[model samples]
Target: MASSASSLTGGISAAEWDARVNLAAAYRLTALFGWDDLVFTHISARVPGPEHHFLINPYGMMFDEITASSLVKIDRDGRKVDDSPYDVNPAGFTIHSAIHAAREDAHCVMHTHSVNGVAVSAQEAGLLPLSQQSLGVLASLGQHDYEGIALNADEKPRLVRDLGHHTYLMLRNHGLLTVGATPADAFVAMYFFEAACMIQVRAQSGGGTLRPIPQPILDGIKQQIGQVTRGVTPGALVWPGLLRRLDRRNPGYAD
Candidate 1:
């Protein structure tokens, strides 16, 4: 395959094809939530192998226009490993590649600069424990201070250091990033993360005394989640419904 629309498989596994569909769906879903920063931020999914290859959007395409077959496969250095007509934004790949290199479980990494996400990032407190949505984010969140544009390779260690074992990373003065073993998991985490940021920004603008949730409640959020959803995987339950919704509205992502 020469990396046209038919490259959705391109000698990849059935699992890889499914990953492509989900990753493409995620791109469209980002558009659905209006979280995309045009062609700036990205969502990358690692191909299931020891080779460190990953799949990212074909640059120059809007998130909503991304398709399963059109994603470009690239290496850790952000160089294209498979043929594609699109040229990737190397600077954008820096952050994604850094996280993918650091976290083995982070098969899927999503970054966004949505209004609330960037607004929350600029806050000194960095995602306060106010709303229940924030509690979900607070459960396993890490924050990294802004380091200007992500064009430097030296930022990788610091970013990995700041991220540590946390599932979510809040880039101070930048935006939100989430990691998941699957695209759906990352998508679900980001949904909660963005919602939390949106709620915090709205609450702060209300011009009233703000109340942070008690620390004890924050600590028990994970346990509470298991109870609330009966321990079902967070994304697994909701992802199908999301795809159905997308199918009804904009159905080309799976192509």
Candidate 2:
């Protein structure tokens, strides 16, 4: 299987092939966790080395169906740089391209429209610090107000500006977005982001007075996160387990 997977890459660099496998896993895990919104939202990864190339899902393929070999390679303009049967998504292009161009550290960008995520995004208060999961997100979160369908090239500036160094972005009345140095980092960040929204929605449905985590505690989340993960990104610590879980439940993302 490993040899077969490598054969599908057409002799790309080992680093690029690794990126493709991780990106494919991220997509499968997103669907595994029920974060996929049909085939609408996207998750993209920067291909290793210079040259401003990226790998995004083939348009119309469900997240679970994505494989490393199936992800399409494209340039910054969302045009295919290699031979592939699949096309990229335009809205995905507008959003992912801007971040990939703007942020050097954003190696992976993930966006999803999960039910709980969209519900919390619709709230004026946005993601409140109501749980431990929320603390991780709140520590580096930003909110971007909805501006139609994100199809316009004009929305890119404001979207990037709103994201502005934050790891988590709540697209108002839209969805959730997260960026990281790798697919693992981005996927883990989105896990917390989505979990935070899910907890908030469930808590709100109870119709009781909400309790926000104290401001000082929220202020220390970065330090706490560092301690909890023992000086590594949470993704690094957990991604292996995530892949193991995927292997047990929905394997073949590496194909």
Best by lDDT: 2
- In candidate 1, stretches whose alpha carbon ends up further than 4 angstroms from where it belongs are 1-7
lDDT (Cα, tens digit) per residue for candidate 2, span 77-191: 9999877777788988899999989999999999999999999999999999999999989888888999988799999999899999999999999999999999999999999
Residue 171, model 2: Cα distance from true site in angstroms: 0.3
Model 2 pairs in collision: none
Instruction: Report the lDDT tens digits of candidate 1 across residue range 1-255.
Output: 225446456677887788889999999999998999999989999988788899998889999999888888899999999778998888778998998988988999999998999999998889999898889889899989898999999999998998889989999988999999899999999999999999999999998999999999998999999888787878888999999999998898867
TM-scores for all candidates? Answer: 0.96, 0.97
The whole-model lDDT of each prediction reads 0.89, 0.92
Q: Best candidate, TM-score-wise?
A: 2
